[model samples]
Target: MTATRQLEGKIAWITGGGSGIGAATARALAEAGAHAVVSGRRAAELDRVAADIRAQGGQADTLPLDVADAGAVADAGAQIAATHGAVDILVASAGINVPNRAFAELDTASWDRIVAVNLSGVMYAVSAVLPGMRTAGDGLVVIVSSWVGRHAVKLGGPAYNATKHGLVALGHSLNMEECANGIRACVVMPGEVATDILAKRAAPPPPEELARLLDPSDVARMIRAVCEMPARACVNEILISPAWNRNFIAPGEAAPRPARAAT
Candidate 1:
């Protein structure tokens, strides 16, 4: 009567999973049969997600962590392994466009803030999980990236652009370097998802414009695809955007639209 979980018996760890794409992917992975560990700085939020998964009869655990801290990431990795086994899937979705201002307007402090979390934090996450994967003889690393990584677009600041671009290169390098070891690395670049990213960037959604953007569920489905895949076939990069789009728009002009009353 119950649907079979796609990743049954596999363990997964999702970073920046308090909300948005990471949170959505966490739920999707659990539905796919993975025992998912959702980690983030907010314990309460992660706990809520974990509880929901449990209520759905899926296995889940929460780890309150800051991926920017390598030590904490490593420790969390160990804890998850001890609790559910070595992770078969790792989703590096924890990031933000800190001080989302123009490149010239970005001071060194703001630049470092974005780089530390989006770039360095991903490194820490991958490194922390590698040992377990190596011991197990296989692993999958999924990095949630952005179209900005492919080619520059609006809101493309120095820090955000740099990290997104670097992630593609990182994913490729990992795939090639670890292919023989049965480790698959992939980057999911999704655009204009319905998530807190705009707010995180202090760019509010346009009530009218919100309808055109991609939803987090779309991105989550991509992550699920990567996670459910066999190591034999690797999806290197997924460049997704709003089915409809404009080259550019004012920051505030991207908000959601109000529903129309029926005539």
Candidate 2:
């Protein structure tokens, strides 16, 4: 772990832990003294992260999972619990923004993929662990949403925006309904940060806009605050924007870049 581990003894499961934000968060949590299990569809990537944690004398495990596959999400949670004894926190970061075409040009398959991974995937992860958290009477869940969730961006594809918007509602409902049950749910809506999600969208940001995105660590810092806070304190939401990203990229220069992945 790091010189000071804030989450020591806690157990956390992060979906979409194969790259970008997910990867950074996993390492950060490990450094903070938490036993973290990172999940993604890539076993090799997850295994590499696990080894890094091992080198630091922190606990970490790998689970290759397709978050869009409900069965896999459920099985991953159960496997994590079976190995770790308990799960005190969850980070639902698995998401996708692909085929950056306007709604008119977008085909059904493209839209479905975006919704499946960006919205349904998060739902699957949350549903898998909530029952156990309810039984335990305590837990924290962090949903990594986006600025598009709050305001639609005509510059980006509609399918991506829609899922993010839905995530806001999900986080809100979870917080309101589970508050009394000792389960805290929060959502984060961050502006662009550097990562490979742009690649998956089969696009890239306009070159001029590349310099102002937020960093992956910035989001990790927010999660660190939430997970380490006193049980009685909860940060309901976080909206992070780049200090210099005041303007949106114009359409036609290139496809817009997506936020960092949970990797």
Candidate 3:
């Protein structure tokens, strides 16, 4: 937590809040005095996150949802508006990947699934909250993109890379059109982080390599900073990675791959 309650009395809505960066961000925001409304597909996991926040003396609520469902996401947004009045901060962190990510193995079903959750899902979530933000004339959107969002990486696959890249354009376009309304949109592109999403990777990193990757909390802190900034300032984008970035290593010099069979 920060020394001051910068986000006190704020209403923050986080998608994919059941775990990973979303869960971490919820905790961080709640600690900073924001009432966090967490939304995800897992009810049990959402409950767990909310309970932990309450235990820590922070405000939190869970709204089970599947971002890929436009109607569901819109309903969730409406529910939040009815219950909380408005969402001051929107963190679009819901995302997914598959082990069969490479083009050679990528099937249409896999591609569609990833697009639904990664690309279309983000669009739905943003559209759901944009109206409220426009009405209030004050809003902050923090989009959790990926390292591949800015730089194309073969490991991330065509579907994942395309969707992540779309997020960048979406954020920029949001700012271009909504900045005058006092709404700020930021695209946070983080490198490989030690999160559950790694389980979907074709070659999951070994323990030693995972140890050096950025933790969920690390990315959460960066998000908190973006939220803490004054309403007058809008951080357009953030590209962050661990000091030991595997992406920077020379070809064929990668870390040892995990022994487990690919999912």
Candidate topping TM-score: 3
lDDT per residue (tens digit) for residues 1-263 in model 1:
16667789898899998898999889889888888899999999999989888888898888999888889998998888787778899999998875446866778888877888898899999998898898888999999888888877757677788899999899999998988888999998887777777766656656566668888878998889878777789898899888655445445445446799899
Using all chains and alpha carbons, the TM-scores for the candidates as numbered come to 0.91, 0.90, 0.94
Q: lDDT per residue, candidate 3, 1-263, as tens digits?
A: 44467899999999999999999999999999999999999999999999999998899999999999999999999999999988999999999999998989999999999999988988998898889999999999999999999999999999999999999999999999999999999999999999999977878988878898999999999999999999999999999998879998775555655699878
Order the candidate numbers by TM-score, best to worst.
3, 1, 2
TM-score of 1: 0.91
Relative to the true structure, candidate 3 reaches a TM of 0.94
Model 2 spans with C-alpha error above 4 angstroms: 201-203, 206-208, 246-263
List the candidates ranked by lDDT, beginning with the highest. Answer: 3, 1, 2
Candidate 1 residue-wise lDDT at 145: 83
User: In the order shown, what is each candidate's alpha-carbon RMSD?
Assistant: 4.3, 6.5, 6.2
Please give, for residues 1-263, the per-residue lDDT of candidate 2 as tens digits: 44687788899898888887888888888889998899998999999888988898888988898998889888888887787765898998888876656877888898988898899999988888888888888999999998788877775578888899999999999989998889998898888877778655545665566555777778888887888898898888888887655445444434446889898
Which candidate leads the pack in lDDT? 3
Candidates in order have lDDT scores of 0.84, 0.83, 0.94
Clashes of each: 12, 10, 0
Instruction: For candidate 1, give the lDDT.
Output: 0.84
Off by over 4 Å in 1: 248-263
Local lDDT at 68 for model 3: 96
